[model samples]
Target: MQDTVRRILTARVYDVAEETPLDGLQRLSARLDRPVLLKREDLQPVFSFKIRGAYNRIAQLTEAELARGVICASAGNHAQGVALAAARRGTTATIVMPTTTPGIKVAAVKARGGNVVLHGDEFDQAAAHARRLEAETGAVFIHPFDDPDVIAGQGTVGLEILRQHPDPIEAVFVPIGGGGLAAGMAAIIRFLRPEAKIIGVEPVDAPTMKTALDKGEVVTLNEVGLFADGVAVRRAGDLTFALCRDLLDGIVLVDTDAICAAVKDVFDDVRAVAEPAGALALAGLKSWAADHPGSGTLIAVNSGANLNFDRLRHVAERAEIGEGAEALLAVTLKEDRDDYSRFLTLLDGRSVTEFNYRWSDVGTARFFVGVALKNGPAEKDALIARLIAAGYAVEDMSDNEAAKLHVRHMVGGRAQGLAHERVLRFAFPERPGAFLRFLASLKPAWTLTLFHYRNHGDDVGRVLAGISVRPEEQPALTEALGALGYPYVDETDNPAIRLFLDGARAGS
Candidate 1:
C-alpha cells in the first residue's frame, strides 16, 4: 500500500493527461444540505480518467516493448484511453472490442489511431481473444483494471483530491466496475486521508465488487446489466478486489434510474452530460445523503463523459423517477367520461408529466399516468393512498423494471382474438431493419399481438412482443424464435403486462 502511494505520487501520466479540476456542486450541495465536490475526471483528454492509468502504464514500457506494440479489449472508455495513450507515445495499439459495441466507440478508437478488432459478443470474450492475439503477435496485453501499474496510475486521482482539498473530506465516492478506480483511490485515501470515508458505488445489476466483498471471494455474475456499459464487468480483478475489500468503507448499489438522475444532476451543476457509469459515484452520494443526512464535504468522481447522444431520451425519461420527482402509476377508472374528469380533479393541480389511456372494455379503462411529486417518495405514497381511498384501483409502476422499460410506451387496447398469447422480451442488435428481420423470421401462421421496442442507443435493442399460437404449434414457435438469433426471455405472465393489458377485461 505504501509503495502504491509512492508510485501514485510519481506516476508519469501528465504527458498526455491533465490534472482535472475539483469543482463544487453548488446546487446539489444546497439540496443535500452539505458541501459536495466533484472530481472532474471527465475533463480528461479522452473524456475519461482511464487515460491516467493507460498512459502511465504505456509510458513506462521499455522501448522494445513499445516496438512490439500493445493490445487490449474494451467496449468503450478504456479503449479510447489505450488508443489515445498509444498514439501519444507514437506506438501502435490493437483494441479488441465486442461485436456488440456501439459504432460510435469503434470509430472513436480508429480515430485515435488504434487498430480496432470487433470480436465476440461481450468484454470477457473480446478480452480472451485479445490475450490470444497477444500470444500470437508478441504484443503486450493491457488488462484494463487488474495490473499493479494501472491501479497505481488511477491512485493519482486520490492523491490530487487530498492535495486539492486541504480541508477534511468526509467521504470520497468512487465508481466500481472491475474495481480499478475504487481500489486505486481507496488505497491512497486510506493512507493519506485515513479519517475520510472511501465509498464504492456500482450499478445494482452489476455489483461485482460488492458481491465479491460480501462473499469473501471474487465471484462471476451470471449476467450484468449493460445500461452502464463502462462498469458492466461481471467479475472484479483479484488485486482490485483485495484492495477494495480491505480499504473501502462501504459500497452502495444504484439502479438505472438513479444513475440517470445523477447524470441530470451533474448536467444541471456543470452543464456536462455524464455517462451512466460516470455518474455512479454521484448517484451513490445522493443516495447516501438522503438516507443519512449529515453536514460534511462529500466528494464524487465524475469519471467519464462518453455518453451516446441518442441515449439522452431514455435518461431524461427516467431521471425524474430516479430523483423521486415523478411517479408512474397505473390507475383504473370507469369507461364513462365523467370518471376521467373526476380523476383529473383529484390531481389537485399536480402537473402530469405523461398520461396514456386505453379503453379495453365497456366497464373499466386503464390510465398510465406520470405525475410530478414535490416531496419525493412520501408525496408519491400520499398521492397513491389518496387515489386508492377515493375508489381508484391503482398500481405503482415507478419501480417496475418491465413497466419502465417497455409497457409504458406500449399502453393500448388489448389484442383481440389472439388466443394463448405468449409475450417475450428479446435483446437483439440495433440496426436498420432489425425489427423487420425479426418479424420476417416468424411464420405468417402465428399472429402477432403485442410489440413494443424503444432504442436506448445501446448495442442491443430491447423488444417486448406477444405471439399467439396453439399448444401444438409451440415447438414451431420455439424453432422460429431460435432462428431469429436474438437473446430472449419469456415474459408472457409478467405482472405488469397482465395488470395493464391482460387482466383489464377480467377486472372489468
Candidate 2:
C-alpha cells in the first residue's frame, strides 16, 4: 500500500492530463444542508478521468513494448483513453469494441488513430476477442483497471482532492465499475487521510464491487444493466477487488431513476450535462445524505461526460420522478364533461406537468397524468390518499419501469379479440437492420399483435411487442426470443400494461 501511494505521488501523467477542479456544488449543498464538492474529472481532454490511467500506463512501457504496440477492449471511454495515449506516444493501438457500442465512440477512437475492431454484442465478448488478438499479434494488452500502474495512475485523483480541499472531509464517493477509480482512491485515502471515509458507488443493477466485497472474491454477473454503460462492468478486477475490499469504508447502491435525478442536480448546479455513470457518485452521495441526515464535507467524483445527445430526453423525463418532484397518477373519471371539470378541481392548483387521456369506455375514462409535487414524496402520497378519499380510483405510476419506459408513450385502446396474448419488452443494439433481423428471427406461425419502439438516441433500442400464442406454444415462443439474443423482460403481467392495453379493471 505504501509503494502504491508513492507511485501515485510520482505518477507521470501530467503531459496528457490536468489537475481537474474541485468545484463547490452550492445549490446542492444548500438543499442537502451540507458542504458538497464535485471533483470535475469530466473536464479532462477526453471528457473523462480514464486518460490519467491510460497515459500513465502507456508512458511507462518499455520501448520494445511500445514498438510491439498496444491492444484493448472497451465499450467507450477506455478505448478513447488508450487511443489518445498511444497516439501521443507515436505508437499503434488496436481497440476491440462491442458492435453495440455507440457510433460516436467508434468515430472518436478512429479519429484518435486507433485501429477499430467491432466485434460481439457486449464488453465480455469483445474482451475475449481482444485477448485472442493479443496472443496472435504479440501486442501488450491494457487491462482497463486490474494493473498496478493503472490503479496508481488513477490514485492521483485522490491526492489532488486531499491537496485541494485542505479541510476535513466526512466522506468521498467514488463510482465503481471494474473498481479502478474506487480502488485507487481508497488506497490513497486510507493511508494519507485515515480520518476521512472512502465510499464506493455503483448502480444497483450492476453492483459488481459490492457483490465482490460481500463474497470476498471476484464473481462475474450473468447480466448487467447498460443504461450507465461507462460503469456497466460485470465483474470487479482481481487487484482492484483486493484493494477496495481492504480499504473502502462502505459501498452504496443507487437505481436508474436516482441516477437521472443526480444528473439533473449536477446540471442545475454547474450547467453541465453528465452521463448516467458520470453522475453515479453524486447519486450515491444524495442517497447517503437522505439516510444519514447530518453531514459534513462530502466529495463526489464527477467522472465523465461522454453522453449521447439523444439520451437527454429520457433523462429529462425521468429526473422529476427520480427526485420525487413529480407524481404520476392514473385517475378514473366519468366520460361526462362535468367529471373532467371535477378531476381538474382535485388537482388543487398544483401545476400539471403532463396530461394524457383516452376514453376506454363510455362510463369511465382513465387518464395518465403528471403533477408537480411541492414537498416531494410525502406530498405525493398525501395527494393520492386525498383523491381516494374523495371517491376516485387512482393508481400511482411514478415508480413503474414499464410505465416510465413504454406505457407513457403508447397508451391506447385495447386490442380486440387478442386472446392468449403475451407481451415482452426487449433491448437490442440500435444499429441499422437490427430490427429487421429481429423480426426475421421470429416464428412465422405467431401473430404480431402490438409493437411500439422509440429511439432514445442511445446504443440500445427499447422495444415492446405483443405476440398471440396459445399456452402450449409459449415454450416455442420463448425459444425463438432467446435465439434473437436480446435482453428482454416478460411484461405480460405489468400493471400499467394491464390497465392501459389489456383492458383489466381501470385503476385496479
| CA lDDT of every candidate | 0.86, 0.86
Per residue, candidate 2 scores C-alpha lDDT tens digits across 92-150 of 99999988787777898898999999998778888999999999999999988988889
TM-score of each: 0.81, 0.81
Per-residue error (Å), model 2, residue 147:
0.5
Number of clashes found in candidate 1: 0
RMSD of 2: 13.1
Model 1 alpha-carbon miss at residue 100, Å: 2.5
Could you tell me which residue pairs clash in candidate 2?
A: none
Candidate 1 per-residue C-alpha lDDT over 211-300 given as tens digits, one digit per residue, 9 for 90 to 100: 999999999998888888889888899999989888999999999999999999999999999989899999999998888778989999
Give lDDT for model 2: 0.86
